[model samples]
Target: MLNLNDLRFFVQAVDCGGFTAAGRRLGAPKTTVSKRVAELETALGARLIHRTSRSFTLTEVGRDFYDHARAALIEAETAEAMVRRRQAEPSGTLRLTASVPTAQLYLADHLPALAEAYPKLHLVVEVTDRFVDLVQEGFDIALRSHFAPLPDSQLLQRPLAREDIVLIAAPAYLEKHGTPQWPQDLAVHAGLLTGPGATTWRLGGGDADEAVEVTPRPRMLADESVVLLKAAAAGLGITCLPEAMCRDELARGAVVRVLPGWTAGSVTTTLLMPHRRGQLPAVRAVVDFLCARLAR
Candidate 1:
């Protein structure tokens, strides 16, 4: 294996003008520094220095080699610094926000580990679907679910999950109401819809350029996803939810997907943070932790 100490020794020798000077700075004997540099040249099968009694100079290849060796040392030092920075225990309040569906399906799963790892780091999480301004709202970071590109802003975005919005209903509901074979048939079933009041549902899929819309005439309406999920599982009516959020329900037969090839579009879960917040160790720790676990 190539020794990193050789790279350090070689770089120091070149910068300090000679092995004797490099050794004084590195707290090693001049002979040891000279030996390490020779080993490096031997490993590469090329001479890196023209040595003499009075002074040493780099050969043509040695000059080129020195540039790369210096660059490598800088990169190695930077990598070590970054690892040390991340290892620093981050402490401070980290204010965060996310849509309800994203919190339940993705963020909730990984946040516990982050909290446990950095007990000194406090978290204040807001769950909502509103488009919150990170700067104006004083939020350090936010998680958002977007169907389209977010409006251009100063915040930075990192994707956490790409969730397909699937329609689901209880088996009892499907058997009693009969499965909808097409998008138009969706109108006939009782709809347990999200958001307040009644509105048309638009689904996009099935090898089509255009989306399909239907007015199911919702018999129940609410803004909460868990409420809708529970209602659908209780044989109330068909509703839309992220497929990942419905995993347990689908597995337990509490709910089954409907309209296999069709979907209520897709949602991208993203982490957003202000540009200034990126420099904070607390924010960096939380962002790194979430990205490591939640990124898909």
Candidate 2:
């Protein structure tokens, strides 16, 4: 007796922010979409949304029902996908997030192939430095780079890469300031530091690789590491950067390594997903694609 089509209309209406928008997306008339959602409300015997002349708001019960409704739709889609996947390619919109630097330096390069391989698949990427609640925010996946192990969470964590951090400065910068020969030599030099800023920078030294922490006087600071990369390349100051990102620059002599024996830091990039949603074909393809590409 449950009308899943009506349920779809209701969910799409909420997602699109209005029945008219949902109808546009669904290739149906606005009146039809609105009526379908109304029939769904009648079946449930609850006022799911409060409609206004220019807008609509989900009722308290509607908010809770919307969450369940989305999950049910996903389940239904997954069941059909299980059959189609054997003969067809994955196709759907996948919403994902990544830090600013990761998006620029890493993910942007890897995504093109996903598009090329799955022409029907659509990707929505959010480039941000802040951690987002995957379920609450409706993101399919998140790529994060962190120093410490991820905190306790229900989200499934997949380790991607542990990249070494290196010290880099433009040839012009060293020409002006002179090259630093030792870890302590960095004290007098300018630093293009990343945020949340580090009070003291830790450097590795000696054959046994002992740790040395130095307080950097920042010439410039930014929340994103890519910003510092630009600043460093412009001869603004020295900064810590992932070695993998420095490959092309290091090869072309655009930037030179400082204090060869010492390292600035390291980072681990991880993929996070909400529960069983990772099993969906489109989501799984992205996960697999990123894992394989980022590994290189």
Candidate 3:
């Protein structure tokens, strides 16, 4: 006979990456979680994971079992939720992840109101710019800005906003170097590109696209988008930033938009959720709130 409790622990362990992390998440001792998973494997007569010192990766059979187990567990929880919903109450901890700027300015700004609306919903937010593994991070939902839908099989995403990009340069830099008159002129001017890829930039003009390869003239290169913004603010070079991120700076004359008519619309913010059936009320409520807020 298979133990449902042990199956739950196995799912959590896989999601969390290691026994220690899974123990912390499940509030159980490492030995206990490890024993349960081991026992499960013994009963199933298959190796579920390939374990190493650094990480534990799922085997082919393990991956297949995890999918079915996750679905079955979620369905069981949903059945319980239906019973709880009959009593009319929403109570659970919601784990959410988002980039620093969006969490600080957009998500956290509106959360107080949502908390007021639903006092039972507890919000735990992880702010990071790095792409987090939803399952391994133990996040119920994440806010991401992607050019398209997420590629992960265990995640589902919904669109939230169509954010546009803008080219920004410090006023002094613009004055010294002179702003580019046309999209093609961007090639000559120094640029502070955000992420490394082929050292090429595509500037959008009305019904036309201009491709420019900008090689910065020996300056500090940063991987963080915020770093590029700060560098641009320090009059380093011209940088492309999301319009929403630099709106205040542009309004305050801290940074000026170089190409007004031309824009490369690439970024988009979306809400990503685990592909679980029994989503806690807190998670659903927050997702709904964000969609409504962004749509408005």
Question: Over the stretch 1-296, how does candidate 2's per-residue lDDT look in tens digits?
Answer: 77888889999899888988898889999999989998998899999999989779999999999989988888987898788788789887899999887787778887888799889888899998776878756789998888889997888999999878999999999999999887878899998876544756898865545788877677887866667777888899898888888878889888888887778768888999987788798899989998888787
List, residue by residue over 235-295, the lDDT tens digit for candidate 3: 9988877887787888899999888887755688878887773265556667778889888
Q: Best lDDT goes to which candidate?
A: 2
Could you tell me the TM-score of candidate 1?
0.66
List RMSD in Å for every model shown.
16.0, 3.9, 3.8
Clashes of each: 0, 0, 0
Candidate 1 residues lying further than 4 Å off, grouped into runs, are 1-87, 128-131, 196-198
What overall lDDT goes with each candidate model? 0.84, 0.85, 0.78
Model 2's TM-score against the true structure: 0.77
Per-model TM against the reference: 0.66, 0.77, 0.79
Better of 1 and 3 by TM-score: 3
* 10 residues in a row with least lDDT, candidate 1: 73-82
Q: Estimate the overall C-alpha local distance difference test score of candidate 1.
A: 0.84
**Would you list the clashing residue pairs of candidate 2?**
none
Error of 3 at 62 (Å): 6.1
- Full ranking by lDDT: 2, 1, 3
User: How well is each residue in 1-296 modelled by candidate 1, as lDDT tens digits?
Assistant: 67888988987888778999899978999999999999999998999999999879998999898777766765665465467567767776789998777787777878888899988888999988777777545688998887897887888888877888899999999999899988899888989887664467798888878998888868799877889899999999999988887889999999999998999988888889877566667787888888888665
